[model samples]
Target: MKIDEIDIRQGTANTPQRSHGNCLPYVGVPFGMNYFSVQTNGAAGAWFFQPDSPRFEGIRLTHQPSPWIGDYNHLLLTAIQWDDATQKPDLAGNYRPTEATFNAHHLALFDDHFNVQTDLIPTAYGAALNYDFQQLELAHHGVAIQLPDEGRFEFTATGLKLAVSDYHGGEDQNLTMFFELSIPNFDAENSGYYDAQNHWHTATNGTGKPLTLLLATTAATVACQLATSYVSAEQATLNLQRLQTSTSATLKNESADAWNDYLGRISVRDHHPAVVQTFYTCLYRLFLFPQRCYELDANQQPVHYDTMAKTVKTGRLYTNNGFWDTSKTVYSLFSILAPELLPKFLRGFLTSYQETGFLPRWLAPDERGMMPGNLVDSVIAEAAQKGLATELMPALLAAMQDSDSKSAISERYGRQGSADYDKFGYIPADNYSESVNWTQDYSYSDYCIGQVAQTLDQPAVAEKYWQLSKRYLNLLDPATGFLRPKTSDGKFKPNFVPDRWGTDYTEGSAWQNSYSAFHDIDGLIAAMGGKDRFDAQLTALCNAKPTYHVGGYEMVIHEMSELAAVDYGQLAISNQPSFHLPYLFDYSGHPEKTQVTVKQLRKLFNASTTGFPGDEDNGSMAGWFIFACLGFYPVCPADAEYALGIPAFDQVTLHLADHDLTLTTANNHEHNNFVQSLCVDGEPFDAVTISHQQLMTSARLETRLGLVPNH
Candidate 1:
């Protein structure tokens, strides 16, 4: 599939009540610093761009990875024609939602009331916007620039230089981004600023207000170039200067080519066109996150604003991602297809550790410290195992140790309840909320740390962390075959209900969170009385009702509702905890069940406006789909292996950095969901897991599926 064929709006039909992927129709290059989305309702707050809404407020400059995380340094640009004194300050024009283009690299919308057609083509740091208003009877046309918070703008020789300071919640509360906009044919005498209440100021420059720029132009078509930076206004100008010579056609073509380079890496041959579309759309999503926060200065050196230090620093930095989500799937995909980019991502993360004392958990410009565990450990460990960013492994290992040694003073950094976990071998439920997840995740993170340590030839350090990795064993309730919460006294907490949600677990019950022993599935199976019992428990989990008790959350969060909405029983694939549940069957020597279960889950996804099962966090869900569709999954990132499953398509070709790896399925039909046999490079293969080395080196994987189980 080509980049132009992708709608980029898959999984965008979302709301606060429920999430159908919770994704935005973003227009930008892959991993671009900025993204532009059409804002339909500004008053909707985080839920601003609903697909069905007829109101076209403007094109929004958004850095919003998720609605829950909100946006930072955002601005809106709207085009207007005749002004009404009695109307509100911000005007909403009508547009055909179905007619507007929501392509991956470009956006085009026509405002009916204003008689204006707007086109936006995005670059890495900025975008070119063309406004055509020839149909309007009035000669004077205006462009309104809206800022979410207090901002300043100065009229320049080209157009205007604007700066806005805004953030949702992070270590850097006062994050700001500078903007340089070039409008060659604007009327300086009529152009000015305005407040929210129709209070207009006739001045070339303004400061310390929630200012909105109203630039008037008599020209029928207005061409505007916008560039932004976190460093300074001068840097923003430099960013704009790079693209000044490029036209709309060139910008659009360049953006398309950039997206095609990444999206074209995977080519699928499926009989169903929808399957091909879903594959490419999901693939497109896998590259949108961990946006580049660093920008090049005048000397073409990477520099970024250190939000913590309140100054510009020399190095790469990235933001708008949570390690808790991405570590599960995103980095593993990167290791396979985009290994070249991993080193820079890790280096940027290392810079985060240097600026702050701890490695980042959730970073939106800076650490927001959301979720449990420092799962960047998984990213580092996987990258180390794959030989990515090898030069930085030593420093990355030290950063992991620093974060593990002590509890963070602020809630915005490091692992919560780290001291308690170290003392009790488990996070005590009496003191902490979601203690079960905290303990389990920390244990997995320790295993990851140990993986990195062993790779660096630090045997003693590796041994120490590997032992600590078994802390999940401390919380296992052997009787129920679940990892339950324990008090500081080493006794299981009373009133143990496996169906209960949120008191001890992160976002799930024991059924979903119990099998998180990623690095030690054998140990988990052994603790549950070996493979038979483990298999029985997993079977029961899938067949059981998706019932829940709102224990701590006191309400049915969207996850719970989504779980019940799907018919997968207790396997809540809507959230991250259950992402590897089906693959646990692989550990029990039941790859047939894994194959069937995975194929069943594929029914929940498609290529449409509402495509996903739930909130697709920072490419994590998309990454999961990508791996599963290719007949394997990264069940454990710390270990360098993928659990094999049934393929979703007839053929999938992965164009890796050094080589091409292809997977083709035989007798591929919806009913033939269980793998009958498999071969690697024309040799018979019999394994539940395939190594990273084998996948990267092998030429082809052929899977033969049948209606019945092989056993």
Candidate 2:
């Protein structure tokens, strides 16, 4: 179905906008089970149906008047009971239905997960349990199930009885049984199912029992001797009421306030649901990290880490392990937009060090040192440059020391006096070729240390790593104009080709790794002789034939190749090295190329089913899309400014707590691919660069576009 054709209902108090389409309706938070179809417009009419039990697969609907059953193959009824005129069901008892009877609803035909694999059935039908049901219909509010046949059915009330008839029958005939339906506290004791120790369990009483149907039946028959005692309706109601009054209430209130603020900042001219979804999804992904660790006490202040008695610790927790890739973009964006969270994340890193004695490579629930680089250096330097105070300097220094001392390079560039300082900056391409290239990973780390040292006013230390930053130069073969592995005597390794994979670096060739000079583009350009030659080589690299094997256990290799094709000749776009490549076009007198490449990449890769071009590497690739679509990208994330790229939307309005920043594109379309002119708050600007501070605090950026290059 077309996304634009779907109707959206924001569900306000009185006036709610309702539309008819098969679009998914979401409430509460975006990450939860909020995507579900509440209604449909067309031939179906107002057929009221709620997904089976929130925990089941059946879509139960209360039919009015005559029972109009459609294709029975699509419906799966787990349990059914009809209330005879004589007695009433307790309206709050847990009844277990037989598997055979339950499977009759077509739900069983699919997998246990209830994901329908086939689309053979157009509709379904079932026997109507003719009983008086209540009707309370309102748009985007609670659903109404009406059964008018029986005397005043109290479906909405506390007590009701329904006699159930199984689809299967026998001679003895389990003819009729009472069915009860009531909403219980989702987290209460003995209230149906609950998650404990990462596994779900249903307690009939206060005690945990093996989740077996026969066991549950035996417990029900035996009474109090079984697991937890069954929770009463009054208790269940109180629990649910408490939950609704507390967590749900608070979330609803906060979400409402956020929504109001969001709406107030919306621009009528450029608003689109796709844009909103992408923006909000990006925002959602951003919050997935630096987890919510601060548990407020009764006074609403954050509690100490020690207070949770070792079960819960207070420090910093984050989600979405996209460090290697995200450090290039997303983290840089966060460092600008949300400086307050920087220290918390740093502290989290420190806590990780304290716990494991090493900074994590890629962290989720565990330490996955999947990627090559120690990107924390970039994050720390960016944070420091942006004026976010962190205890990262010492940690970075220690990490650098560890990396240096452990490297084969350090052993080669041995210092006569200090054993630790021996050959500290050199990595030999001899015995430790593989490890040496990996050791070159420290080049960026050293660059970061230089920034951190400069921030701390330690010029000597900064200068030391600044020289070390030229290690990429050490690997550079002036003979071939490619960054190749070097021997101990400072000679280029023999038989080095720019395109061959392996020996030169891991997963990438010299053509891809040659652009590792993002830390110093001028030095790299000079090393390449001049801007003209640099531009030519960059063009060659972008258009170069793909020689690397496309498929392997490592998906990053594939992505690196893709991204490399977009950057200054050498970017392995599908890999991490090429992340800053597109932005480098600005320095090479080709900012328009950056714009074109960014637009092409973003258009090809998005947040849909086929969104990512390669392995996400945590949220790194995702962050790239976020930054690119938002209009600018951090070329040297260690620095404080973002180089402009083509923006995906005509306008993007970021609604901050205190102010809003709107970016508007003019003369923008598929045909107009270059920036003809630009302005910030009507002030004419010649450059396409923006500072981190401007992005976080500016009022607006009005960009005038054109078909040709502005220069």
Candidate 3:
């Protein structure tokens, strides 16, 4: 399947808290610093685009990752019909939803009421926008740009210059991005600024204006090429001059070529077209985050503004990534396809640590630290295990130790209770809010530190963290088989409802979080006494009704409601917490059960506009789908192996770093869904796991499936 044929709207058709993948229709190069989406409705804040909305607000150049984190530097670009104010339509005119195209490389809109054809072609730092008003009867047609709430703009003969107020969680919140927009052949004098009072003033020169786009032009086409820079306004103008020479159509083709080069890395041959489309669509999402934030200077070197130190720094930098979301899947996948990119990202993050004095937990423009866990531990550790970026092992291990040894000045960076956790082995409920989850995640993070240490040949560091990794066992209530919160004196929380969402757990109840001991799955099962009891408990966790109360959260969040809506039992695949739950049965010596559960879970995803069954979380869930479709999953990312699962495709051709690794399934018909047997390189592979070494070598993986369970 072609990259241009993939519609980004399939993943982005959503609103806040609601399922159906709460993603924006992003149009940019993979891992671009900025993403562009056509905003049909502007009322929802960061949830600005909805495919069903009838209104065309503008094209929003957004730096928003999620509605939960909101937006930092954002602005709007819209086309206006310059008729008499009496005869002119509303500022936000009604448009045909059917007449707009939503895809990764192209965003084109046709508004008959305004007689405007607005099309946007995206690059990493800028975009080419074409606004055609050939059919409009008005004497002049113009483009209106609404600045951010605290931004400023100025107009010139060719185009304009503006400053986008930049902030998302850094010490230097007052930083700004300088932009140069090249829109030539338009009426320069009539285009100036709009005040808060809704009055337009013509100006050849101005500063600190809230709006820019009052223009009356005779030209049929208004061509705009916008570029931004953190270096200076002069650099911004130079950047625009370099890339704005092509038409929007030509730029769109160029962006499409870039995407094609990326998406063509892996392809599935001789599969259903819908299935093929879903595979490529997921691959598209896998590259959307950890956006490249630095640009080349006049000397052709990487430079980015250090938001924490309020200084321009020389180094590679990236932002808009949540390690909690990307650690397990995105990091692991990249280790296979692009081995070299991992070191670049890790070095960029190391630079962030040097500037900010801490490794980032979650970064938008800066550290937001929204989710639980210092998951970058897993990210760096996985890289170490895969031998992808061994050169950065020393610094990466140091960053992990730094985050583990000391808490940040604020609770949002590094571990929240690093000192306390090191002392108590578990976060006491009295001392922390989400102590249970904090404890659970810390255990896995400790394992990650050990992995990196072991790779660097630090045996003592490896041994100490390996024991610390099992700290989740301290909080496990053996009586209930759940990792319940324990008080300071080491007693489990008095009241425990397995369905009570978010009291001690992150987004789930006790049942969902109990089995997250990824490093010690065997030890966790042994803690439950054996396989019979463990199997029974894992089964009960799924068979129970998806019930909840306000035991933890004041009101039920959407995950609870989504679970009930899907009737998937307590196995909430709609969220990330439960992503590995279905596969947990494999640990209980029931690979057949894991097979059936994952196959049923596969039914929830399709190639429709609302493609995902739940929030894909920056490709974490899609990464799960990508793995499951290929007949395996890396259940524990800290380890370098993948647990087997039912393959969704008949033949998957993976373009790995070394050689092509093809995974084929015999009798992969819809009815023959269970994996009966597996073979690799014409030999019967009896093991339930495949290592990265086994995958990197040139080989063929073939599995036989049956309608009945393998058991």
lDDT for every model? 0.89, 0.45, 0.80
Ranking by lDDT: 1, 3, 2
TM-score each candidate: 0.98, 0.61, 0.97
* TM-score-superior candidate, 1 or 3: 1
Q: Indicate which candidate wins on lDDT.
A: 1
Clashes of each: 0, 46, 0
Output the lDDT of residue 114, model 3.
Answer: 74
Give lDDT: candidate 3, residue 421: 80
lDDT for 125 in candidate 3 is: 85
Clashing pairs in 3: none
lDDT (Cα, tens digit) per residue for candidate 3, span 268-356:
87557787788788888888888888988888789998877787889999988888778868888888877778999999989888887
lDDT of 1 by residue, 409-508 (tens): 8878777878888899999999998898888889998999999999999999999999999989999988999999898998999988999999899889
The candidate 3 region of ten consecutive residues with least summed lDDT is 82-91
lDDT of 2 at 651: 81
Residue 649, model 1, lDDT? 84
Which predicted model would earn the best TM-score?
1
For model 1 the TM-score comes to 0.98
